[model samples]
Every structure is written in C-alpha cells, then in structure tokens.
Target: MPKLEPEIADEAPCSAEFTAYDEEHLVTYLRLLDAETDGADWREVARIVLRLDPAVDPDGARRCWESHLKRAKWMSGYGYRYFLKKPRGS
Candidate 1:
C-alpha cells in the first residue's frame, strides 16, 4: 500500500476531466471504494485509510471522506475512461 498522507484537502478537486491529483491518489480512491464495499465505518476509514482522527475533527474528517468517496465513485463510473485514453508510459 502507498503511504497515507496525514494532511488532506478538505475537498477533492471536482472537474469534468480526470486530474493529476486524481491519478496521484488513485490508490486512495481504490482503498476508499474497498472500505465502502466492506461496510467499514466512515470514522474508522477516516482513521485507518485517510489517516484522520474523527474524534479530533469530525466535520473535517467527514468532509474529506465524502469528497474523496464521491471522486472515487466518479473514477469507477466515468473517470476510468480518461485513464484508458492516456498514452502508456506517460
């Protein structure tokens, strides 16, 4: 697994196009997807996957969680097409 960053943006980038940030955090998006599929608690996901402590900053943690998960779902549904279109070994 990739190293989890302790600091995260409060909101992920929301764009019609897949972003460099999206590519950089692809592992995180996948982990978020897996955690959701596994019925993991958001707070626990925040702690374990996102490296956030909900007990310390519930609102921030939730905001980051929701935004990232939304982006993750977008990747699963649509953004993957953009990835496929990228030239190999860019």
Candidate 2:
C-alpha cells in the first residue's frame, strides 16, 4: 500500500468521484481480493457505500466505485489518478 498525497486522493473535487482508503486499509482489501482467495462480496461493499451517502445515486456511485477499485493503488503495482472539471455554478 502507498500513502497518497491529498491532491490525488479522496480530497479531490467531487466530479472525479475518487474514493481513497488509507494505505493499510487498501492492502487488506486487495489481499482479500487476491486471486488465490475466493472473491470478495463486492455487492456488500457497494451497498454500504451507497448507503453511506444519501446524495449518491446508486448507479453513478457504483460506476465511480468500480473505477476507483481498478487502479486506486490498492492493488499491486497500481497508481492513483485524480481528474475532474470544476463544478458548474461554482
């Protein structure tokens, strides 16, 4: 796991929809998702996150969540990326 700077982390603008876990947490999650192991119950993860924020639309949140997991630096040799447009009416 890697410690990411705030700029490319969950602190980024909301449009990016980036979700970040701390280094230690990231490691454990990925280990549970390891190939040798049975797959994690991602639906539960999805359900929890969607419920965590009432503002989140399930479909959109799920997509953002999937994107975050793919290369959120939680998996071995992965990297974090943050990008988003400034919000409208700002």
The C-alpha lDDT values of all candidates are 0.86, 0.38
Candidate 2 lDDT tens digits, 7-66: 122221233333434333344335324522455454555444322232455555555445
Q: What is the lDDT of residue 31 in candidate 2?
A: 35
User: Where is model 2 poorest over a 10-residue stretch in terms of lDDT?
Assistant: 4-13
lDDT of 1 by residue, 1-90 (tens): 123553467788899898877887788899999999999999999888788899999999999999999999999999989988988776
Among all candidates shown, the one with the greatest TM-score: 1
| TM-score, cand. 1 | 0.89
Clashes of each: 0, 0
